[model samples]
Target chain A: MRPQHLLHQPLTTQKCTLGCPILDRCLGGAIPCNSITELVAESGSGKTQLCLQLSLSSQLPASHGGLSASSLYLHTEFPFPFRRLHQLSTNFRSSHPCNDHDPCDNIFVQGVHTVDQLLDIMPRIESFIKNSKSRLPIRLIVIDSIAALFRSDFENTPGDLKKRSSLFFKISGKLKAMAMGFGLAVVVTNQVVDLVAPDEGINGLKVGNLGCLYSSGRRVCPALGLAWANCVNSRLFLAKDDEFVHQDNQLVNGDGGDFVSRRTRRWIHVVFAPHLPKLSCEFEITRKGIFGVER
Target chain B: MEISRLPISASQRGKLISAGYTSLSSLSSVSSSALASDLRISESEAVEILKVASRGSRLGWSDGTNSVINGAQNAWDMLHEEESLTCITTSCADLDNILGGGINCKEVMEIGGVPGIGKTQLGIQLAVNVQIPREFGGLGGKAIYIDTEGSFMVERALQIAEACVEDMSEYSRFLRNDVQACQVKIQPKDILENIFYFRICSYTEQIALINYLEKFMSEHKDVKLVIVDSITFHFRQDFDDMALRTRVLGGISLKLMKLAKEFSLAVVLLNQVTTKYTDGSFQLTLALGDSWSHSCTNRVILYWNGDERYAYIDKSPSLQSASAPYSVTSRGIRNSAPRKYCSDHQSNV
Candidate 1:
């Protein structure tokens, strides 16, 4: 038997569209299946909003770039955004009137407070998927902000670091295997932390390239260092920058440009992806859902 | 070959053999500390055993009586090989001149810059230009482009390939007097087809794909250029352990260097720039810290020079430290026309 043939088969060719045409196009059609895609950003950048939007979209019919399946939303950050999910469901209902089923009814929400709890739930999730009573198969598994579970779990000792990294690999390894076996799309959210540069002198900084990544205007890197970074198949960075917008309504002529208002501009950057070029596009989060602004 | 053959104490030999390190080759890669822990011996005794094993292996090699030293080449032969090494052009005249005709094969070259400084453009240009027929003074070989940042666009590659085809046909017209050189058999589609694209999602996959390149390259011997578009993206993220990151990067660089030499192909590693806090302020430098600087045979830093894209040879053993102006034109990397001096232009990180 040709082992190469089995290995070369395109395993992750399916995509669950983000529901917005421009955003989907930016992500090369949609969130690819059989891979772990991470969303990293500071708070209020709409990482959870996007995940909520995805939970609803995954329930959409296959013709609309969905799996026509259910989603498992595992949240580590508090009080499941029930109201926001409700608002999104109403919009989803209006958008696709043909589907009479409640978009919210299909989503399975599980709150995890600690790292041990999250790890313990892995087997249950597998069993749930294997013997799901619902008509739709679970095609999406989302862990909203994976960094939260590990934030206070371990201290900064070498042994603790090793243990934390091993746990990271363990979780991701299981997630990857589940994704490949079940053909599900795994979306994990990660928070960002202020990057503290090493105080090592100029020569020290030059000895090891400890460069920093900037999001919005602040110098921040994704929470959970390189070990977690290696676990995700793709990383999407969301940033918001406050910009002064000209208040054109107050001006009678083009010269009256002194009146301005401040507004936050949000952008989604493809930090790294196997199928995407390094690209970024502006997006907005409204009551309806997240939509990509055409450039 | 066996552990018993080592000139070590009988008890130590018994422990090593019982612990399953029965051969010298198996013990070769094992560290003394690890061997000591596994065999329940002191570190000093493990070291002695390792020393004797190495000596025994050396004697075994001599007993074989091979004429040539294994994998060793004299300096004179190496010079001849280096002189004949081929280079894949970036298609920009000034960039090519400073790059010593073009990006030299059998060596690893790292090119890094800030976002949108045309690193991907240069990578794609080289991927297309590598396929330029030998008649046109090119390598006429295939290219393997490993895109880590998803920055590689097929539409952009297609456009560059079309432009490359046009350039070739135009050159053929100039060499019309030489009847054999006027045949432009390659097409834009063919150029695109010749490029094998790999989309790497994670650092592990990136490392795995790089390791797999040896077997892949052996199968497709015509692959003369390996382009890794941004090797630092995954390695720079989420890594809290600086020591492990350094060791991982070092191993990868060694593998890449070996692949370059063994396959006689150009290995171009595209890198991203990171902000470094130095002298009480943030300064933009290439990603993947200082130790990674020694990984490649050549390092080229791309930056903005008063509204013009310039590439500076930051480090190279043979090439002089110099900078040249280039541009990312619609047709891909090309020579930039001298622009009016603008003092306000600052490096955009």
Candidate 2:
């Protein structure tokens, strides 16, 4: 193919929207097709919540900023959050009344336990995406928390490190190939690790300023480190913050004094992306679904 | 070492093993011209085989020894890099002054304090402030937050980020003459987005993550700060093997120090305070023992002085032992309010 022809090639890659307009705008028109997007956060930072919401949103029509396709949710964190999924589906059903069939039926949920199991299911997942009987083709794949599988499986030895990193490449490489080959949006959730300082005692090692990033008043960095960081095309960080919002209710209610309430505020950050700038926006998870909070 | 260990073709390995050269050391001493005739190979092929053998041999590797002298840098270049090193402001001018213009890049700084003394707040502030554009006298770099104790609050980070944005806009208003200075394109959300957060559960995972940071920082070259909140949390708990913990911690610290220097990024290690029995009395000291103290290039202790919080420069290679009062408000770390003025106002009221 000529170099100029490459530029003129029609952009056939579609986007699977997060169902939130503000977030879609922040993400430069939702999650792009043919790439891996990583959702990194702590346990309660709503990584699963967003994934569950995506599973339903991807089923929406193309006019609504969705791929108008089915989804495959490869969940490592169980028991699958089915109750939450049901609630989100109900909300999804109410929002888009045009679809006759249930949106939940289109989402294929699979439980992945080990790295081997995840790798074993790759070919099956590809075949499923390729030759599905349903009208809605599988255009989205969600791996809820990729870090859990490798967290305790590997030892911290030189040999194990090599194996673990190679596996990381293998898994991500397959996922990327499948994504690009099938025009699927692969979203994987990853855990975080505490960033520590390098010691000065070790010989032949340079010591320098050690800094950290914080979320919810705690220091944290994405889990799995550099090997995994390189695998994903984009990384989105979800963080929650707890603050005491004092309300002066004394004037409104004659007897009531100042009321202090602790509120948990959630935020989503675009750590790095090929198309979007490094940005963040406040988001809240509600019964309706996960939506970006207007600034 | 066996001849099979040499990275060569299987046919060459078979020929070498079939001949007298069963071990890598035997081939290491053989001349390429002599080996070429004996092995029935070309002179260039023999040279290649011998080169691989020497590299595989234990004592025949002299390339590394020669390269060490070649890699040696003069003190002048070191001084130049040091002079150009930028700092991530703590947002507290007094604290930044004591810190020699905030927490400097290319150094591992240990900030230890009692719980609720705002160690995490300062960490979040640095994470937010580090993203300030270079035009505003900031590094305009990203951050890597490794949360061990699960104390990182995103809400607190947003609050700080908002304050940083407000401060930058205020700064831009002051410098309206300069076109670039007038345009503050960064937002609070962008500041939050630039910070990469990691949560570590165990000391082993922490070590693994630290080992992984060298490569991580290489790929994310724009990252200029790495913060580990309370580096002592996992080490201090369930660690009966003191020697092993020390060695592991030493390795991790060394890796972090290397990352800071290599990436020109600042690493801030938050530590907890422990009571030490010394001089017939128990006094508060930074946790992870005395040997761990030498791991950092600088150490600052946050303490409460009556009603105010004070950060004391406990130990540093270049900085003097100085104390500065700073407070962690809802907005983030800032200069402590004048206590005398507050007291007089209260008395008048």
Candidate 3:
């Protein structure tokens, strides 16, 4: 029998490179692997677009700190925007390349809606690994908006949030395991909800309301509450401010007339990460997607 | 001496480390090849190391080694479980008073209202408040917002951010750490895909999210709060099949109940109300019916009367049902104590 001092079964740290040149710097070389990371913000704040960019970005070679692997892109609310992804892929390839000639055949994108169905496909991810002939690594995974599946699959019954959240935890656990087992980086995009105070209390008491009213009145539904946050190693919130616009004053997809207001300066906040400090910086969603703007 | 007997290889060690099994506790939990596959190493080498390294100590396979390994891993798991609890403070003095100073950590809560009644506003407010620290009852943690409705207002979140900043202090480092509010307008398939991808964390994280509020309670100790704003948006549009809705709702409820007690968090859900006909008069009823009612600890309904905001507590675990007046000002959700003005005043309560 061998001595016990040398077995390091799990390596908790893996760094993955985000696709965009702008974001790669902000992420501090690469995104931490084997942990749950969040990229959030308001709609049109560039959550989906940023995720798409990363899905393509992870395909770069490891020499540049990229994942050099394929990704499982999960879509919740919208269909997979393959056209946009293709366009962005070509753009990224033409913009930067290690060999200039090396093809980005490494990244693979997949979309699903219901949490259950998503879980069902998880086992197949291993097959994807084997099919790559050990050449293309499955290094990064992305989930664009996990809430849509809970909303669509579960009826908006009084207690569905509880049910949906429970199901979500189960599914999220599987994804985390797969990512860890495959040495992949996981990136999940989530929807944002408003939390106002409750109106029923006396003395102007405001109650914080979770936004799953369809599943109202079932014990406590912490759907994606503390549990979701606890599972992942990092969390990021994306926001946009007026600064996202350029001097040319070009019209961005999500940004229109709102660019001039004091509130229009969109900012993406790095809420949680291992090596990252908590910072909120200005950014913009252009014709392509979310990009960090220089002050 | 025993090192000579082990068949482990450098390649196998590399694979194990890449798979996040750096500690003996992590290794004891999985198959030898599982680590090998994750790290792209040979499984036989991984098993050989496991056999010899686990000597007679509690970490060993046959001797006391397994117990030691299991105990250490279990302890670590507990540490993580204790850490998973999330806490958020509701910036309201009176509301906080009822909720033991603020929204409890690690639990899920709901808020419901009419279209313009500020359900989303409350959610955004809490998401901002959770970023605050312990002196204020928050875990100084970040918020993970999943926006199903198209209206995940960053402007509103920023508005709340500004509010938090107005009351910021030097002692609290939470404000410096920006809380993340992810606005995901998930299409049908996107939601499912996200959940599958979400499950890739350690078991502790899954349990933590499951019994969210309880986990928050333990971590922050005083932290206790979770807010799901308007749970109806996704379901109202989808689930054409009623039976599927019930099945899914039941599943969701079980998870939430577990999340609430295990985490000791205050969960607030924002529920929607639809019109129901009673005799000749039409009345409004909360959506989600018994399924929602059974899962929540408390339920509040919000309705608008001109500019006046009114709310009724329909369900409560301990407190009695009560109705109160309120106003949705630019400052956010404000609770107002109903006063008796005149004998002729028609009371909606």
Candidate 4:
């Protein structure tokens, strides 16, 4: 029997890399390639930024912390952070002059507003993979944020958490299959909510559910908490440093109306990374991207 | 490619295999006409192949199908006992002790409690525990968390990590010293596609997702647990075509149960509480309907007493339906012996 025809080899073991230098080290490699790697955090926690960077980085070749692979970035809530992404990309290109662009040519970005759109494009994505003649490779895949598409795309309106989750179950499955078949890495960002404690227990907080919000109690802890934390091969929780603790006093010029701080010291912490031995790492949001700093 | 002694094409052998005529008994019993019809081959050819096989010459082809089935069942039973596949223990030692060493694979343990009862916290803690090494009795695998409530707090995950590392004695430790909170990978994407291995499937998607999940389980084979914090919300939102609700729920439940069994992975589903209109009093209800309830081996109902206090029980299957009082502390579920809030009146009913 032909090797491909023989079913001895399982297809789910392909590993992809996210382009972040520090992250790649922590993960031992980029998010284990073909596995579903979830990046969850509260809003403004740089989840989208990480997703964008991965989309762009998946195009880089092996020598530059990338797999010379292609990627499909699905967007829902916000417009592609084009200007910021462009800035990050251009800056990386300028900094790494030796790195060429053809490696990234395979990377594709798609914006999806609803679940139907996402499903509709899945076949097309497969076709793209089928038709591509390039040996450049396609490895990383990302869903900027799945919550928006879940909330706005479904027919059974909100207020029903059960149906929302059911819809998501279907969606996640398709993405996972695509990732597995193509040996591509998947990175998805999720939103989080605060809780009002009735007492000391952690479940005291109220949070959203269904349509990918991830319930409060069952989900609230352990590196993004609950089902969100439970679903991925690995998960990472990112949070900006508390302004009071890390804000740069030098940035506080006491001018420019309410925003006078230049060094408002924003830091991203690796609140969760399971496979990597290091439980936490600190990064400063530099002009290039999240720059690794001593934790 | 070099060891072929027969002139028959491989496709022919595949056809014969699919036709269920691999053994002498079956091949002999099947008439040439029936075999021809099933195999889409001429009756003469079917008879010829059967004759060759019936000659009893050592072709190594005629094996009893019953033995094959029995072999498969035995292997499945052995797999069913894979040690890593078990329910994640809650912080409550007593509760974990009762739960067959904390959460058996192929069963859905629903943790349903009112708000402020620490359902999320307990679930998070278990997710972490499930990843602990086997010496601690954990399955030592990653956790897949579906967060609907958005209360997936990283700080709490950090706290739990800190507690877990601290609680471990020098010998019980499975993690490295440099382990920081950053090591826990967390993806907060809302898209179902990004919800780990699960897919955001519709009716058609569900079928596709199930096939993919089966394939995925076969691949990872290490995943010992799956946690759908709230399985209810998704169904309630997506299945507005109420007519399809039962069908979808049944299909999903069956697939999940099968997945748990095949992969030897524990399934911990967090359920929501619903109220009945008759008494105008609130009752905890799993979002999934009877299909899900019946499918689940263990259905737990959690309710709050307005504070950190909560009540729960193994609600169904009648095999294990005892109510237990557990508190959701910062550490995790604290199912201490029996608490004041442990209502006997509720259990008597």
Candidate 5:
């Protein structure tokens, strides 16, 4: 097959049927259906929340700029939160009113424990996708993280690197091929590691007089180093403010109104992407899932 | 008592190598009399060899370094050629003047700034600007941009490239792709095609790219500029061992210096800043610490003062430390005014 088929225009240049509300913020325009996009951040930066929202959003009909299809959710790091998924689906239904379809039926969830399990299950999933294409819409694929298994299995040993890197590349290569071949929106999440200590604060937190008080960590780049970083086409960094609060969905308005109980603001910084400029937008996690905070 | 200087035979050197005494430091660490018995050399000669090895390791390179020694007249001839050496204009005349007419081809210059201060923007502009034709007072060459932080934006480069094409009519003679058309319209796509872009994710990849650069440069001789966007990002973050990182950084810098001098290519190294707590408030400093402070031939500090962006010449042997104001816009980096009038008004104050 000609690689020319793989060189289709990015979603930014094409008219996206899925009118994702926050598309202009994190992503420049539409979801790049032809390339692999990585969302990397520290813990509790709302990566899973974004994935949940995407899973539901991709289920919307094609008239609203969605693939009106199913998604394959691979949770490699943490337990799948079906409760949160239901809440987001409910919120999405309330907003659109017409998209009354049971969103869960459209999304396929799989939990794999080890790297070997992931590699083994991937081909089966690919074939299943091929067979199920006519039955349902398979739009997006999210591996909660591509790094969890590799980070744990590879013990910083010189001997394990060759094996580790090859596996990493193999997995990414498959994801890329599947995304291009099937025309899927692939959103993978990655974790970040502390590079060095930043300037000292009152108690290890660096305070900016006018801005947010982040921790004194010098470099908080994504984990898995450069080898895995180069594999993805676009990378977005999620950072949360130091203000932390816990509340229930009783505070969120189903009509996308003002939030009653104060929610911690999360920022999604587009670290690097081909079409998007370097910018960040404030977002928040509610019972409904991640959304751009209405100013 | 350097063994070779003491008239040691070739067989004795071979025996020393076989015994695992490969370096002077390793040899000097052992007891001389005990080593003498082990190597079957005379006691006095062994003692003398140990002493000389210790002195050699401790003292400066009394032995020759890898660099060649040139006479003053020959060096003066090089100095004369340096005057006509092609420098890449940074688009801002004042900044270029402070930079001694943009970036000198035979020198490695560093531009340091914090995360969002447009250090990468400057590097990208230089890469795009390198394609300006010589007839229009441009470098008339291509660029090699090695992006380490994954910060190289092709769309942004396209924006800057499109902005550059607005003024392409005057420089069309040096940049025309074909002789068939008398009036040529420069395409931004052609400018993008001229730049050689390489994105590296890890420190190992960065080192490998630096090692592979010589062959690549020789093959692409039209590339007159090399831009390493934030050299410390990979080295600083991935290396758990600080010493190893420094050693690798040193090797990379040395390789860059060699590449600049040998190929007559200008090297622009973008650096991220570190935060240093000084006088109660935190001050921004260059990352990679002092060991790397001396690596660049010239160092310019990019910082924000109140509203406008200022570039200060922090270190240069031939020029005094001075500051010039510049701004980041859709048209790329340019003079902050009419800054000549603004600075004159400020100087009087």
Candidate 6:
């Protein structure tokens, strides 16, 4: 229980022992364990998609840089994209050799639609993780958007601000407790609100100056503002820039309208974290899952 | 009253006045010690002069004449002013539908786009449109257009107003109403007169103007729509320090919000887009980024795809993520011409 006892052995050096290849680069080395790591992005910026990936990756055998355990995915936003998951897991297993268990069996899915339900399920999940009766121990817990239920249930009325603040604080405390106590990686996703200036000229179309230390006039910011922002241990922001769509790459007008599918490339910005540098990496969603688009 | 016209001696007045500090509000704001140091007068004398200058000007409430409940009740009445809680329509029915009826009062709505994407045109159009009579489906309120980047175009506003008048004329024609009556209410000159325009050149001035707005707006009670055509222009270029810029911008946003709610007015913030470079590439991001992304109740993102103009509901309290095709015509922003038989097109038509 002492501070020194906490810093011993496997804990002394923090590394993703189940070495996901891109973790070292994308997540600033190791999918940080025992901390609430937030992946925030605009809708279709692939927050859920990236999380689906980590769930599959976490289920990979330890030799493949996975914890060789199971993932507890508490999907709050949407019915967990089962078809997409099936497609991804099928593709993942084909590419990586799997000796025994089905990947689906390892990923535990729970659908939570209310704050009370989310709160009610956490202890059950903890006891489930601690029961030690299962073949695979839980190594990762993915909360696909921690904000949805809260946003829907709690109106930001003047009276409810304090209530919202308390609720926010409590949620953060609980997530931190579960992650740190169980020594598992708790990954959560948050939605972003558009912060872009409503009025701008198209001048300097191609050249974007990172001259300012801050995000250059970026209005699209993660939701659940500062109070909830304070609760998460590490935060990563994802954005997709479809601005560079080429004329040659245009798809055939399937809809028979001007609706040509535009290709978008996403960038993951390491918003801020104790372990990670405040930097970003370009990535794309392929049939294979979220792959970092190497420059 | 001018400080020079004050009862004080000419020499004393000359000593007291510093640039524009002769104004009572400015004088009241400075500490007596600071004023004394600048004017070479005793602190007591400075206080007396400031006190005299502020005569019959808004003195802070004394102990017993007013009760807190009186002020509270007045505020309660002002906030619940349902008649003023109207939206200034952008005139594009489909876009208006997604916006829950268009740019609304008592909230800040930002629209971002790359330069020359009709952000200014929309802003100018709103300023003109806000003046339309309430009976004719407009807010029937004055507008304040703060042109930060010199983007406010009077010519374009006139053009939009002309188009509005033509439309109003058509509506009247169908109703068999008098042409002169419609012309009187929807005239281009009257729309221009209702829109109070001001040009701001710096972040400091922008802040100063916003700070002064609470008082300015209180005096001009009819002004219901406040448009800062491109809010981030000076703030982005001027503030090199991110934290400082965020703080100043936050302060301005809060002040604007307060003004919006207090006056039952709509605050339309026009913003420019900035590029956020990540990894090896850059993406177009709204200016001021995440730091300011959530203050607005709704946001409409006007963007171009292969030379075709579209407005996307980037964020809203009620609407789903949707896009409405629109174009910048000589008459200002109009819904794009309906296409041949897409189900969406039929509904839009």
For lDDT, the strongest prediction is: 1
lDDT of 5 by residue, B170-215 (tens): 4555577666532534567777777787756566767888999998
Candidates' C-alpha lDDT: 0.80, 0.77, 0.53, 0.55, 0.69, 0.68
lDDT of 1 by residue, B1-349 (tens): 6777676778888888899998889998999999989999889988888888887788667654211345666677678878886778999889989988999999999998755567778898999999998888899999998876554556567778889889888888886887776778998778877888886656898888887888999899999999998797667545779889998999999999999999899999998765554655546678788898877779999976545678999999989999999877668888976553223221221
What DockQ does each listed candidate score?
0.03, 0.02, 0.03, 0.04, 0.05, 0.01
Give the range of the ten consecutive residues with the poorest summed lDDT in model 6 chain B: B59-68
- lDDT of candidate 4 over B1-349, digit per residue (tens): 1112223457766787776655455665667788889989888887776665554423334432222222344445455555434556676766665454666666766677543345667766776676665655556676555544333444455456556645644323345565452243322111111114332322444345545666766766766666665565444343557758877666767787888766767777776654322353333355555566676667666654432244446564533555455654445456543545435622542
Model with the higher TM-score, candidate 1 or 5: 1
User: How far out, in Å, is residue A184 in model 6?
Assistant: 65
Q: Write the per-residue lDDT of candidate 2 for residues B1-349, one digit (tens) a residue.
A: 6777666899999888888899766876789999999989999999998877765564335432212234555577677768887778888999989888998898999998764467777888888888988988899999888876544545557767888898888888886877765767997767776788775655676888888888777788999999998687666544557798888888888998888877888999998765455665445678778788888779999876655678999999899999999976667889988888746844662
lDDT by residue (A12-91, candidate 6, tens digit) is 22324322355346664546676667887777788888888888777666556567778899988766799998998888
Q: Interface RMSD, candidate 4?
A: 12.5
Tell me the TM-score of model 6. 0.42
Prediction-by-prediction clash tally: 13, 54, 163, 121, 7, 27
Query: For candidate 3, lDDT tens digit of each residue in A151-241?
Result: 4566644366445544554565565556656766778776555434433222122112212221112112223443244334466665443
Candidate 6 or 5, higher TM-score? 5
Q: Please write out the lDDT profile of model 6 over residues B1-349, one tens digit for every residue.
A: 4466566667778776754466556776788899888888889998887776655243222422222233444445454664446778888877787777888888888898764466777888788778878767777898888866543434446668889878777776777666655554557777777777765645676788888888788888999899997687565442447788788888888899899878888999987665454564546678786878866667888876543567898988767888887765667667876554434643552
Best candidate (score: TM-score): 1
> DockQ of candidate 4?
0.04
Best by DockQ: 5
For model 6, the superposed segments whose C-alpha errors exceed 4 Å read A1-295, B1-84, B176-183, B339-349
Q: After superposition, how far is residue A88 of candidate 6 from its true place, in Å?
A: 69
lDDT value, residue A198 of candidate 5 = 44
Docking class of 5: incorrect
